[model samples]
Target chain A: MTPGHLRRDAALQTVLWIAVVVVANHLASAIPIRIDATGDQRFTLSQAAHDAVAHLERTLVVTAYFTADLDAPYHEHEAALRDTLDALAVAGAGRIDVQFVDPSTAERAEAAQRAGITPVTYTVRAWDRQEARSVFMGVHVGYGDRQMAVPALLSIPKMEVELVRAIRILTVDPEDRRKVALLQGHGEPNPADYPAQHPLYQLRARLGERYEVVQTVGDAPFDEDIAAVLTLAPTSPMPAATLWHLDQFLMGGGALGFFVASAQPDYQRGTTFEVRHGIGGFLGSYGLALGREVVLDRVHNEKITLPAPGGRSVQVDSPLALTTTHVERTAHAVRSLRSATFPFAAPVVVADPLPEGIQAEVWIRSGPESTARPGPIPLDPRLLVEPAASEVAGPHVLAAVATGTFPSFFQGQPPPGVRADEPLAKGRLGRLLVVGSGDAAANNVDFVLNSVEWLLEDPSLATIRARATGDGPMTPPPAETAWRWKIAVVAPQLLLGLALAWRVRRRRLA
Target chain B: MRNVRAILRRELIGSFGQPIALVALAVFLGAVALFTLWFDDVFVGGVASMRRPFAWMSVCLAVFAPAVTMRAVADERRTGTLHVLATMPVTSFQIIVAKWLAAVILVAIALGLTLTWPLALAWFGDLDPGPVLAGYLGLFLAGSAMAAVGVAASSSTESQVSAFLLAVVATGLPWLVGYALPLVPRPWLGVVNYLTFEYHFANLAVGVLDSRSIVFFASVTALGLRFATHALEQRRLA
Candidate 1:
C-alpha cells in the first residue's frame, strides 16, 4: 500500500476504535450488573425485599422526594437510594414504578409534606459559602388506597429492608392486621388524639400502619384478639382488678411492654416526685428489679440548652438525658438501632437467680460512667453537670425483656380489697419488655417500635433497619494486636525482597 | 497475530531483563503496604476489607506506572533502536500493544503480590473475597489504562523524563476532574463525571462492576494505545 493510504488507514482505524469504545461504554452504562462480595451480602437484595416485591398484586408506585445539589455524604445517599430503588424495580418484575421528584418548588414541597415526607435541613458548602438548604430525602410508597412514607433515608445499610417493610405493610389487607391494645386510665397521652407535636403521635401512627391500635380502658380484660399491650407512663396506680386483668392477659400468651417511670419529673417545677403505678411488684415477680432511683450517665448523655438568670442559654451536658449506644449486643429487636436516648430514666436489674423458665435479657444500659440518684430527685438544671468520682457506678440496665412462663405476684394471695375466684397460678409462655423510663421513646421512635415488634414475635427487618452504612465506625484493634499485624505484614514482604535480590545476584554470579 | 506475539514476548523480556523493573515492583509493593498499614491503619481498623489499600492504588499508579513505561519507546528511540524496529515487518499497532501489555503485566504482578493482604485478613478474621476480587480487577483495569497513556507519552517524546511527566499529567488529570464535579452545571455533571477515570474506578471498587465502568476503562486503554500507534506511525513517516 502507498504510504499516504497507509497513514490514512491507520488514522481511520484509530478513530473507529475510539468511536466503538465510546458507544460500547454508553451501552454498558445502560445495563448494570452487580456482584455482592460483602460477607453480609449488603449489595445484594435480601430475600425479604424480593418476597415483598414479588407478592405485589397491584402496581406499587415509589416516589422519592430528594432535593438536587445536596452536599457530601447526602449526595451519595441520594444516589444510593436511587440505585436501590432501581434494583427494587428490576426485582419487582415490572410491578414497581419508581419516580424521583425534586421538591424545589413550593407546590412540590407542599405535595411532599402532604404525602408525609419531611424535608431535612442541611448546611452545605456552596460556592465558597456555607448555605443552609432544606433538602428532602424521603420516599413515599403507594399501593391502591394504602400508602406509607419513609420520613428519612439517612442510612443506606437498611435502605432496602426499610423500603421492603414499608411496601409489605402498605400492601397487607387491613382486616388481617393484628391488634395492639394501649392501656389507658392514667395520664398517658391518648393515641387517638394525634397532635403533631405530641411525643407518641409518630409512634402511634407507625404502629397503626401494621396493627389496629385499640384503647384498653381501666382493667377491661384484654380482648381475646389482642396480640400485645403497651402501657406508657401510668401516673395513677392500677386497681387490683386492673393488675389481675394484665396478669390474665399474660396467662393468655399476650406480649406486655411497660414504659413505666419510677418518678415523674416536672421541668417547670424543678423537682421530681415518686410515682408508684402498682405494677413494680408485679414486674419484680417476673425477675426484673425496677430501681426507684433515676440514672445519670455522664459519659453517654445529651446536652440541654437551659435558660440562665441573665437570659443567656447555656448548653449543659445533662446526665439526666442519657444518649446511650449500649444497646442489646445480640441480634434482637434493638439490634438495628444505633443508639437510644432516655430522659430521667430509672435503673432495671435482673434477679440474681431469674424466675424459673423466664429468660431475662438486658436490652439497654447506660455507659460505664453512670450513677443513680435516689428519688424524690431535684430537676434543677444546675445539678445536671458532670458527675463527681464518688457518683460513678459502672453501668446500669435501663431496659430488659423476660420471656417464658412468669409466676404471677398474686399467685398465692390476691391484693387487699379484691375478691379473686381461683386466680391462675402460672402464666402462659409470653414476652415482657420493661423500660425504666416512659420518655425512652421520646427521642427514638424506632426504639419502642422495635421492642413492640419483637414482643409480637415478628422481628423481620429490625436488624436490617439498624444496620450501619458506609465504612461504619471501625472497631479499633488493641495497640498490641495492631503492632503484631504490622510486623506480620512487613516481615514477609522484606523477605521476598531479599530473596529477589539474592536470585538476581546468583544470576549475575553465574 | 504472530508478529504481535513476537513483539509482545520481546517487549516483556527486554523490560524484565533490567534490574530497575524488580526495583520498581518492590517500590510499588512497599509503598502500598506502608500507606495501607501506617497511614490508613487497615490492620488497626479491624476491617477485613482491602478497601483502604485499593483506595490508594489509583494515586500510586498515576506516579509509578509512568516510571514503568517511560523507557518503552523513548529509550528505544534515544538508543537508535526505533529505526531498526520501524524497518521490521511488524505494524506500529502491534508495537504499541506489545509495549502497553508489558507494562500492564508488571502492574498485574505487583497487584497479584498484594493478594497476601486479603489472605492474611482471612486468616485473622472473615474476609469477603467478592469485593477483594472486584478491587483487584478495578486496579488492574485502571493500571492498564495508565500504562496505555504512558506508552503513548513515551512514543511522543524521545526523553524519558519528558515522557514520564507527560504520562503523569495525562493519567492524573482525570483525578483532578473528579473533584471539579460539584462545580459543573447540573445537566452536564453526569457527562463530565463519566469522562473521568476515577468515576469508573470508584464504581468498580465498590464491587458493582457496572458494564459502563468496564467499557470505560477498556475504551481508555484502546484510546491510549491508538494514540501511541499513531505517534509511532508519524515518527516512521517523518
Candidate 2:
C-alpha cells in the first residue's frame, strides 16, 4: 500500500473504533444488564419487591427528598437510594414515576411536610467550623389517594427493603390491612406526633402503613379485630383493670409486642433510674423475665461522641449503646437481620422452664464478651470505659418470644380490680414478644416491625422486609485460618516467580 | 488476522525471552500480593472480596505497564530491528496490535495470579465471585488502556528510559486529575469525573458494568494506538 493509503486507512480505523465505542456506550447505558452475584442477591430486586411494584394497577409516584451537597456518608446513602429507585423504576415498567425533590426550597419543604417527610439535623464540619445542617433524606410513595412516607433513610442496608414494604403497604387495600393497638397513656411518645426528633413517630408512621394503628389509653377494652398490641416504653404502671384486660386479651389469642425498659436514662442529669412498670410478675409467670441490670457488650457495640478535656468531642465506644451482629440464634422474624443496636438495654432472662405446650425462643442476645451491671447506674461519660475483670461475661438475651397456652398470673386469685366473672384458669394459644429495651426501636425499627409482623402470623411481610442487600455476615476467620489465608494469597505469586526464575536459569544454561 | 496472530506469537516469545520482563512480572505479582495481604488486611477485614488487590493492581500497572511497553518499540528502534520489521509484508497496524495484545496478555496473566486471593478467601469464608469477576474485568480493561499509553510513549521515543517515564506520567495523569476533582467547579464536576480513569474503573470494581466506563477505556486505548501509529508514520517519512 502507498503511504497516503496507509494514512487514510489508519484514520478510518480510528474513526470507526471511536464510533463503535460511543455507540456501544450509549446502548449499554440505555439498557443496563447487571448480574447480582451476592449471596442475598442484594443488587437484584427480590421477587417480592418486583411483585409489589409490578402489580401496581394504579399509578404509584415515589418522591425522594434529599438535600444536595451533603457530607460523605449521607451522600452515599442518597446515591444508594437513587440507585434503588432507579431499579424500582425499571421493575415497575413505567407504572412507578420517581421524582427527586430537593427539600432545601420552601415549596418542596412544605410538600415534604405534607407528605410526612421530615428533615434530620446533622452536625457537619464546614469551612473549619462545626455547623448544624438540616438535611432531608426521605421518600414518599403515593398510590391513588393513599400515601406512605419513610421519614428517614438512616440505614442504607435496609433501604430497598423499606421501599418495597412501603410500596406493598400503599398498594394493599386499607380495610384488609392488619390492625395493631398501641397501648398509650403511660407517658410513651404519642404516635400522632410528626416531629422529626420524636422517637416513636417514625415507628408509628411505618406501622400505620401496614396496620390500622389505634392508640388506646388505660381501661380501654381490647378491640376484637386487633391482631396485636404494642406497648413501647410505658413509663407509669398500668391500672389493675388494664392489666386484667391485657391478660384477657392474651387469653383470647392476641399477640403482645412489649418493648419495656428496665431503666430510663436522664441525659441532662447524667443519671438513670430503675423503672418498674409493674409487668414483671406477669412476665415471670409466663417463664420470661427482664433483669434489673443493664446488659453491655464490649465486642459488638456503637460509639458515642463525648466532650473531651480539650473542648472537642471525641468518639468513645460505650457499653450502654450495644450493636450486635449476632443473629444466628434468632427466630425467622429476625434471622435475616445483619445487625441491630440496642441502646440502654436490659437483659431478658428465661426465668424458669416453660410450661407444657409452650415454646420460647430467644431472638437477640448480647455477645459472649458482655457484662451486665445493676441499674440505676450513672449515665456519665466515664461509665463508657472498658469492661473490667470484675464485670461478668455472658450471652445475655436482649429479646425473646414465648408462644403457647399459659396459666395467667391471676390464675389462683384475680387482681383487686378484676371481676370474678373473667376467665383466668386456661388461656388460649398466644404469642408474647418481649424486648428488653425501648431504645432499640429507635435504632432498628426493622426489629420492632418484624416482631409485630411475626406476632401477627404474617411471615411473608416479615421475611420480605428483613431481606437486605450484600452478604449477610462475614465472621472473621480463626487466627490459624487467617494465617492459612495469608499463605494461600502469597504462595501463587511466589511459585510463579520461582518458576520464571527457573525458566530463565534453564535458558541461560542451555 | 493470520498476519496479526503471527506477529502476536513472535512478540509473546520475544517478551518471555527477556530476563528483565520476567523479573518485572515477578516483582509486580509479589508486590500486589504483599500489599493486599498485609497493608489492606483482606484477611483481617474478612471482606472475602478482591477489591483491595484489584485496587492495588491499578496502581501497580501504572509502573509495570510502562516497564513492559517501553522496550516494545523503543528498544526495537534502538537495536535497528524496527526498520527490518517495516520491510516485512505485514502492515504497521498488525505490528501495533500484536505488541498491544502481548502487553494485555501479560497483564491478564498477572491478574490471573491474583485469583488465589478470592480462592483463599473462599476457603476461609464465603467469597462472592460476582464482584471479584467484575473487579478482574475492570483491571484488565484499565491495564489495556495503560499498555496502549505505554506503547504510544515508546513509539514517540528511541530511549527506553524516556519511554518508561513518559508512559508512567501518561497513566498517572488520570489519577492526579481524579484527586483534584473536588476542587473543580460544581457544574463541571460530573464531566471532570467522567474523564477520569479511576472514576470509570471504580464503577466496574463494584460489579457495575457501566457502558460509559467501558467506552472511556476503549476510547483511551484507541486514541493511544492511533497516536502510536501516527508516530510510526512520521518516523518513516523522516
Pick by DockQ: which candidate is best? 2
What lDDT score goes with residue B59 in model 1?
Answer: 80
I-RMSD for candidate 1: 4.0
Model 2 lDDT tens row, A44-125: 6777788788877888999998887666335457767888898889999999899998888899898888888888987654
User: Which lDDT values do the candidates have, in the order given?
Assistant: 0.78, 0.77
Task: Report how far off residue A42 is in candidate 2 (Å).
Answer: 4.2
As a whole number from 0 to 100, the lDDT of residue A112 in candidate 2 is 86
The CA lDDT at A68 in model 1 is: 80
The DockQ values of the predictions, listed in order, are 0.34, 0.35
Q: Lowest summed-lDDT stretch of 10 residues in model 1 chain A? A: A468-477
- In the order shown, the chain A TM-scores of the predictions are 0.76, 0.71
Best prediction by TM-score: 2
> Candidate 2 DockQ category?
acceptable
**On a 0 to 100 scale, what is the lDDT of residue B165 in model 1?**
98
